[model samples]
Target: MSPVNTSSSLRPSSFLLMGIPGLEATAQHWISIPLCSMYLLALLGNLLLLAVIQSDPSLHEPMYLFLATLAITDLVLSTSTLPQMLAIFWLGPRSISFHSCMAQMFFIHTFSSVESGILVAMALDRYVAICLPLRHSAILKPSTVARMVLLILLRGLVLIPPFALLLWRLPFCGHRVIPHAYCEHMAVVKLACADTTANTMYGLAVALFVVGLDTLCIALSYTMILRAVFGLPSSQERLKALSTCASHCCVILIFYIPGLFSFLTHRFGHNVPHHIHILLATLYLLVPPMLNPIVYGVKTKQIRIRVVRVFCVRVA
Candidate 1:
């Protein structure tokens, strides 16, 4: 070996991120145009929502506060990956430092977990408002809302560290190319040369235990809300209560359905085309942030009015 060594393996210090597999260079540029547009819409919409909530004193209730928290989470979630993704697509800086890649993965997953928790909090808020209307204000005061936000933040903070650390410890000696746009937890871990059993199992555990539990709780809350809504004496009252939850239900479906599909396909559908997986992952990341604000703006009458008034004032 000392005389004529031909097979020495060296771990790459950096990773090349393929923004989307099977897309040509020109096609990537075309895709970037739409991707950048979505990023702008997400930022503008979330910021506008925040500004409206802040300026309006009447929206100082728990529901609006939770919405504000959701806006902030969506803002972070989109920002966490879009710029780097755009760089990979628009320019050609496809290389990410190992540590930087790890950081990106951490932020992406942490904010995602936070968003899921915020949705659950919103469900609980709606349940209180509809199921226990008389005690809604007493039960969900500003202090309680603040605590809920803190707990949501803590939930992400606690759950993501171990995942990140596990990935960090794995020795990645193979090709340092990520096949997707962003540094998704599983995507990065799959590049490791070491035994990935722990990483795989822990990731599955987080998805099943954390997100699964959140989904279950949200379902229970909504079921109870439905029962209460049905028990209302007047059909109009039931409709009003159900209307309050419409936007939330839409947001929940948008956030979870694509994500679940992407997760399942990533794990099981080895025969699925590479581009399909990448596209689904991209949609999972981009769609919710871009759509949540629109859903709320169109569904919530007060927000719609405020948005219209703001536009009118600006035009005038």
Candidate 2:
């Protein structure tokens, strides 16, 4: 295929984001209603989770600290893309500058990596709490938790630059129209005119290394946790031990299920409708952030009580 406008510049100055493919004409305005509602819920829920964790000293243990980290990650992750998405849906197709698109891509992937790490940390917290009950406090002290959070941030920062750099070196065909609502890494990479073998392989490797490893670690942690729980002396003890993990398990499912589906469909689902892929991609980001706090608030008694008390105090 002959390149369009490639002589002027190797890359376009801005990308035209086409929002959802088929639905952009008629349905996008209606779509914004639920999208806006979900974004607001994500904001409210995660902020409330952070506020509750911060206000109550009693809840400042390793698990809740990890919860706070997850909440903050969720807040940033949703904010990075959703507002722009809303603008596109409510107004029309929008153009994002090359640098701005790259920035959005970095923030989305980096914080997503951070969130996956946080889930592993939460699993570790549960494992330590269940398997090494006496040593849990000593092992996951505030200082240690702080360092872990720092390392999670560092992992994302250190790993994601290569993605942008790899794409930066490639020549675009001057067709700068991105078919999705936001700047997803693979979607943007597909716009390049050159052979994208390196970009594709590197993205796959990173996903497998980061998310794949995190999933393995979480599975191992829960394996040990279940063994320790089942070995308890009484049924009641087993049930109590299992109950502690319920919220984490739910959160993990909600997060990973849709995410993996979206990832797979993006790469492999040639037969799938473009709108379906876009909707799945958008939902994966919004759903987890909206549901995470609710799952914790309902499953964990401490958060539930504090959430109630927080409202009651405000009312009085």
Give the alpha carbon lDDT tens digit for every residue of 189-293 in model 1.
Answer: 888777889988888898897789999999999999999899989999989888999999999999999889878887898998987788778878788999999
Once superposed on the true structure, which residue ranges of model 1 sit more than 4 Å away at CA? 1-11
Model 2, residue 231: distance off in Å is 0.8
Worst window of 10 by summed lDDT in candidate 2:
1-10
TM-scores of the models, in the order given: 0.94, 0.96
Candidate 1 local distance difference test against the native? 0.86
The true-versus-predicted C-alpha distance at residue 88 of model 2, in Å, is 0.7
Estimate every model's Cα lDDT from 0 to 1. Answer: 0.86, 0.92
